[model samples]
Target: MAVTDPVDIRLLAALADLGKTAVHELAAKVGMDPREVAYRLVALSGSGLPLLVGVESDPQGLRAAIAGAPPSWANRPPQQQFPAPQQFAPPSHPVPQQPAPPMPPGPGPQGVPSGPYNVQGAPSGPYTVQGAPSGPYTVQGTPSGRYPGPPPRPQFAPPPVPIDPAVSTWGLPQTASWARGDEPARPAATGKRGKLGEVMETQGLEGEQLSVQLLEVQDPADYLFGAAGYRLEAGERAVVVHTEITNRGSIPFASLPDNYLELLAADGTAIGKAPVSLTSRPPHKIGVKPGETLGGHTVYVLPDATRVVSVRWSPRPEPDERTLTWSIED
Candidate 1:
C-alpha cells in the first residue's frame, strides 16, 4: 500500500506536472501503456493517495458491453456458432435398368446371366454404373443429383470500431491529484521585482532551480517582423522580449523555459506571447541541461495604443508568487 515503487513515483511525478490529462497522454509522458497507467492510478487510489480514476463510455457501447453483443459500429452480421444443419432428399426419379443380353446355347452357370449384360443401362463391364454423377448426389432442393459443397465458410475480419473524438481510448480521470487535495499548495510568489538584465532564481515544477533574466525588450519591432516575411494588421505593432534561462540545480529543466512569458499592459491586462518567431533572433529551444544556459526570444503583437508596463514570466499557465516581473521603462 505504501508508494515505494520507482515506477509509481515516476507516474505520480508526471501526473503532478500534467495536472488533468488523459490516461494515454499521461502514459506517453511516462513511457508506459495506457492500461498500466490506469491500473497504477487505481492501485494508488486504493492505497489512500486521493487519486480519482474515472471512465466515460458511449451510450451504445455501454449497452453492447452489458448485453454481450457486438457494438453497432462494428457493422458485422450476427456470428453463426455452428454450420447450418445438412438437409437430405431422395432422388426425384428411379434410375432405369436394361434387360440382360442373350446367353450362348451351352448351359450357363446356375442362377447367373452367363452372357455379357448391360449394367445400369450401360455396356456390360465389372463395377460400372451408367449416368452416375461424379461426386455425392444432391440431397435436397434441385432435381439434379449434384452435391453442392458445404456453404463457403463465412469470411470474418476484425471490426473497424470508430473512436470517439471526445473520449480517449483509456478514458479520463474526473479529477486530478491536486483537485483531490493530494498535492501541497503552490508556493507563494516572491514580492521582488527585477529590472531588465537582472537575474532571479526560481524553482521549476520538478523542484529544479533555474536562473531567469530578461536580457532585452524591443518595442515597435515592425521592421524585424516584416523582415521575417510576416505582415501585421493595421494599428498593430510587434514586441520581442529576449531572455536567458540557466538551470542551477542538478535536475534538468525539460520544459520550454519561456512558455508563459508575457507583457503586462498599462491598464493591468496581461498580453500573451505570440507564436511568431524571428529568424535572426533565435527562439527558445525546448529544454536546458543541468548547469547549462539557453537564450530565447519571445514575440508579442498588440495595438500600438497599448502601453506596455512590465514583462512577466511564470513556469505555469497562471502567474504565481514564483513568477518574476521586470519593469519596462518608456
Candidate 2:
C-alpha cells in the first residue's frame, strides 16, 4: 500500500494538464527518466489509481482547457505557451487605509480598497478606503491618484453550461459518460446427488476426498436381527439402515482388517442370538477397491407385540417424515 510520492503527484497533475502525452514527453515535463515514468505509471496502475483512458479528447470538450478558453483560468490568445507568467500584471496601487470617519454604508470611500501603490505614495487605482460596494467595480488610478473605471465589457455570448459528472472518488472527468447494456452471467453451483437407502438398495455413500464411506442402522430392528437369527417379538432394529459403500478412504487401520455387520434389537435378541464379541456376520477385510459396491440390510419388528414381521422399506436418509410427505411443486 505504498502511496504515490511528490513525483507521482506532479506526474498526475501534468498528465491532467497535458491530456494524453507520450511517456518521453511526460518524462521531460515531470523531470524523470522515461523508464522511471513508465515504472511509476505501472505502480500507480496497480494501486487502483484513477483509470487511464486512451481516447482523443473531444475538441469541443477540450476548448475549456485550451487557448481562448471559456474559463478565465484557461482563456488566452494563441501563440502563447503554458505558464504565461507575464500574462497578467497587478496594477500597482497603495493599500487603502481606514476611512475618514469609517462610517460604513454612509461611506466616505466606498467599499474596501484594493492594492497597487505608486512610488509617489498614491494608490495606482481609485480603490475605495472602507465602505460598502459602490458598484461592484475596480478603478485604475493615474500616478497622480486620478481614478478611472474599467474598459467596456467584451461582446461575446456566455459559454454553454455543460453537465458536470464529477463522481468524486478521484478528480477524474466531472463529465464522463457510459453506455448501457447487460453483462455476462456467472457460473452455477454443481455437485452430484446419490440415492440413499438400505445397504442393498442405497447408492454410494463414499467419504469425500480421502476416506471410507459409512452407512449404519442404529434402529432397534437391526440390532435384533444381527444378534438373533430371528428378529425378537416387540423388537425393532437398533441399526435403522445400512449404506452401500466403497472403501477407498485412507485409514490408520490396515487395508485388510476384521469388520462386522450387525443388527441389534431393543428386546435382547442379540444376546440370545450369540454373545460373541463380534457377532452377526463373520469378520471380513473391508479391503474394498475404489468404486466397489457392497450390500447389507436390516429388518425391524413391531413394538409391544409378540408378533414378528419384517418392516416395510422406507427411503434411506430422508431428513424426516415431513420430508417424505412433501410434494414437488409444479
Best by TM-score: 1
What TM-score, over all chains together, does every model reach?
0.47, 0.17
Please count the clashing residue pairs in each candidate, in the order shown. 2, 37
Highest lDDT against the true fold, candidate: 1
lDDT of 1 at 213: 92
Encode model 1's per-residue lDDT on 1-330: one tens digit a residue. 467899999899878755665676567556577888899999898888868887653453443344444556333332443334444544345446766555444233234322233345443222433433333232333333333332343545444455434333332443221221234446555445888889998887778888999999999899999999999999999999999999998987877777778899989898877878899889998779899999989899999999998998887655666788999874
lDDT of 2 by residue, 1-330 (tens): 545588888778767654565565556545467778888787787788774633334443343334345465433332232432333444775555643432223212434443322333445444443343443444444334543433433334336545334421322332223211133323332122222232222222222221222244333444545565554443332333333444443422212211222222334232111222224533233335544545343332334332221122211111112111111111
- Count steric clashes of candidate 2: 37
